[model samples]
Target: MTQRFLRVAIALVCLTATTAWNDASSAVAETTLGIGDKAPALDIEHYIHEDNGFGKVEKFEDGKVYIVEFWATWCGPCIQSMPHLVELQNKYRGEGVQIVSISDEDLETVQELMEQEYPGKEETFAEVTNAYTLTVDPDGSTTEDYMRAAGRNGIPASFLVGKTGLIEWIGHPMELDEPLADVLADRWDREAYKEQMKRQEQFQIAMQKVNQLAGSGKFEDALKVVKKVLEDMEGADDPRSNLIREQLTAFQYNLRLDSGDRSEEVMTFFRDQLAEAKKDARELTQFSYNMMASMQQGTDLGPLAGETIAALKDAVGTADEEVMPIMYVLIAQMNASMSNFDEAIANQKKAVETSTGRTKERMEQMLEQFEKMAAEEADGDQDAEGDKAAEKVDAAK
Candidate 1:
């Protein structure tokens, strides 16, 4: 644990109120499916978008590539990926490619979503999704065969079937371009890809154990689970392996800090992250928030955050407009903690400008408090000066 790592500095899953991974990903109990295997039958109950001319696939139709995506109306990631799926359908529909999105909800739930207007568009959800095949299965029969059988519980999981009725790829829909192109051109190395997905699925299972241990307050044991995986994957340089390794390495610090004991190693890790992420606003914001939150909890991070306050503030310069307001509030709060009321007030004003609605009102209120504190400090300084002058006059007399 003391040795240096790649220091990839992945984002930490936050544990503010308590140091635990609050995972929202859906999970299945068992997996009987794998890449390079035959895709399950398209046991659909109803095609919601059938009336829009987007038909269905009764089974894995031979020679036509299919992207079977599992999603739900309530899953945010699922909803966000809808536009990308539509784009893929447009690009490949004429090329013998079909995109079928399945939801495990009832017809009524999916129909309700169709009635709502699309974001930033006048069309309804049904209209926006008319380009792709949208279906709902109340019985969850298709989900059992695809999602459950694959040991997948996450929404927006896309299963790509190659021309031979075999499942070629399974992953997020947004990342489908490269692999889908490969499958279309017959350039896919199914054997190698299958191994990669297999390893990743195993990694996900290990992560569940790690999360359990961390949530149970057994931080050391939780770290051990990650360490074992890292050790097993020591020489693997594949993107998925590297990403998982990096994520696990960064995740160690969270477990360590939350274990009611702190180490120099953990402190050094964040200190290095603060220094490395100084130029990347999003990364800097995340790192700063993680450190600052711990600081508020009285975790003695050895002034790691205090000493690097200037660099954290520097992120504000490079931050995106949406992120700029958060930087202002973070800086303002840190300044207020050190009793720099004027600086805090300035930042609060910036926050008020960048934000709207309730956020703006809250920032305005914080600005007032800082102004009041600054005025009181100014009056106290003037009284001190007056007393000092009176003492000088008495001495002269």
Candidate 2:
């Protein structure tokens, strides 16, 4: 990774301790599901049908080593990994390894892709489905359940369930062969497996609460829930918590902005959020600039000007090319709001100089507008002086 990326990683590591958002540690503890965790109960519906080469198609049964893989047809990685999964199915066929690929997509969407791949060969499709279960999750229940156990950042995430009806491993299908071999050999760590299952179960409960709060638009409440969940994780840092923390911070910022109250209470609340968000480099540098710009436009500088400028200067020093220009624009706007005209002009000039495309154009327009507003104020002042002079002459006469 680049130096900038290294810095960001360090920042996230440090911030993880301070953040009280989603805690995968607690989820892990509660579910006790990990590398060696027993796979939780998973009864994925078999939605597709396929006929056999010699005769009729077959259906699937539960309580087997079902390799329930979460994938999407549209996902490139998922597509790339499908063939490997097919190979695994051929290799592990009747030995009790059930490979199931399920999508949250509709039947029509999945059927279209399958038809394109197999043409008029419904028999082949049915055989494939029975051998390697391909199904859809309509209400997202199965997806939710699995996500709680193993939070997938993207598609092509697979879970290896043992014949004892426990999740053996959760990772990419490409990595499944080694774990599969181990499970087949009966050379697995049973203790670690049980602990991982516990963690997965905990994560499931935490995620359920998180989803419900998010669905209800109770973002603040969701944040609270996430904090409690993370606390339960007992300081264990996981990618899921990090992702949720990033999202929750942005959601909080948006909620504060959209409230439209503008009272001291509101301003103080937003200012505190901006202060707390510094640890999360992603949210601090990315969304905070947007918040700062909005504050400048709204003229709500109860206490954010100095705080924003300081934070932005730090961001400008550390931010990559992608975020640097925005930092410049936000600092310039904050300077302008503070009436530090020279500093404002310098920062705005830098914003225009370093930026390109639509951003540069926008900065340039802001400079022009600031100049016009200043000139108009100057003209008004001169007219007022002329009136004062006329009043003095009248008094002397």
Candidate 3:
């Protein structure tokens, strides 16, 4: 009986090991779409304003020329592509082309986020809401369907679906102006567009997954996804693939700091990153340095303080007039972290003097608050000294 039980236990262990290995292999396996595959279908319940100026719902048509753009409130690239998308929608709406910018964010969250982003512009807000068919699918079934059908891997995935409900073209938004125009004009070959679609579909799935994770505050999980892509890039010869690797690294660094794991090691990590990053890498450098400064949390910035201060000072000398005010405020923040109150005050004062509109008022308020805090610190020092003298007097008595 003991021998029989041992044999059974060994067999179970072998089966479990085989199952774990298969799961691991499946996780990394790529399931990309190719030509002739039926495009995944989704029921996107698009929204528009009602006659009462409240809300109305419309479903996507089955056979129509449409572009469904997956984007988010926080995506910089998505934001950058908005004007072009607006232009495309305006130009194509008359041609039976439907352009819907759908998101996984719910209606209330979308409204609140839009309010913050659009500010006082009701016209622009309403135009965006209507023109792009800004509908939300909280369960993300639409997003999943799109990704699975188009082989999409990221946000800002623009799919040009044909009147036959087939994916004719899919790529980044930048490709829209040319390819979309050709596709709409009936000048683009279906086979060529379908081939390009497959390539982009394979390329974007990891990016889509990363965006999904990051949007949900799953930074660590996003990092893992990006890291896997980076690892897979070792043998790939694509320039855009290389760019994604660098961007993912920079994003992971920023997300790591944001997750409250702001140790000196993270600061050092960014410093090393800045050194290795290309000289033309302005945005990543700025993000890294800014996060590094923030890690100080108002404490004295030690040796690294001079580096941030110098970088800001150099930036100010050549920065465009529009960007100088922002640089000035960052410089002020660095000086404040060093406890150089006088220098901090001077920098903030420069920002206030040079800035216009709401920025100027905000900078002025910050300067005033910092000056008050400095004065209070001085008063507190005086009180401490006086209390020490009083203690000596009482002891003598």
Quantify all predictions' global Cα lDDT against the true fold.
0.72, 0.58, 0.58
Per-residue lDDT tens digits for candidate 1, residues 67-143, read: 99988765545765778888999998888998999998989989988887754467888888999999998899999
In order, what is each prediction's RMSD in angstroms? 9.8, 14.3, 14.9
Better of 1 and 3 by TM-score: 1
Which is the better candidate, 1 or 2, if ranked by TM-score? 1
> After best superposition, candidate 2 residue 272: deviation in angstroms?
45
Against the true structure, whose TM-score is highest?
1
Instruction: Look at candidate 3 and tell me the lDDT of residue 35.
Output: 42
Worst ten-residue run, lDDT, model 3? 16-25
Runs off by more than 4 Å, candidate 1: 1-28, 51-53, 261-268, 271-397
Candidate 2's C-alpha runs over 4 A off are 1-40, 43-46, 52-64, 118-131, 192-397
Model 1 clash tally, residue pairs: 0
Comparison by lDDT, 1 against 2, better one: 1
| TM-score per model over all chains | 0.66, 0.38, 0.47
- In candidate 2, how many Å is residue 174 off? 0.6
- What TM-score does prediction 3 earn? 0.47
Instruction: Give per-residue lDDT, candidate 1, residue 357.
Output: 37
Candidate 2 lDDT tens digits, 1-397: 1223223322222221112222332333232345545555545444664442211113323534668788764553465466677788888776766676778888777776665432123443334445566777766667776755454444567777776766677766776787788887788665654555455556556666765665566656766775675566665454444554454455454545443445766677767777776765556654455555455334355556677678777767666444465566556555655555567667767767765443455667666655554565568779999999999999999
Instruction: Score residue 182 of candidate 3 by CA lDDT.
Output: 73
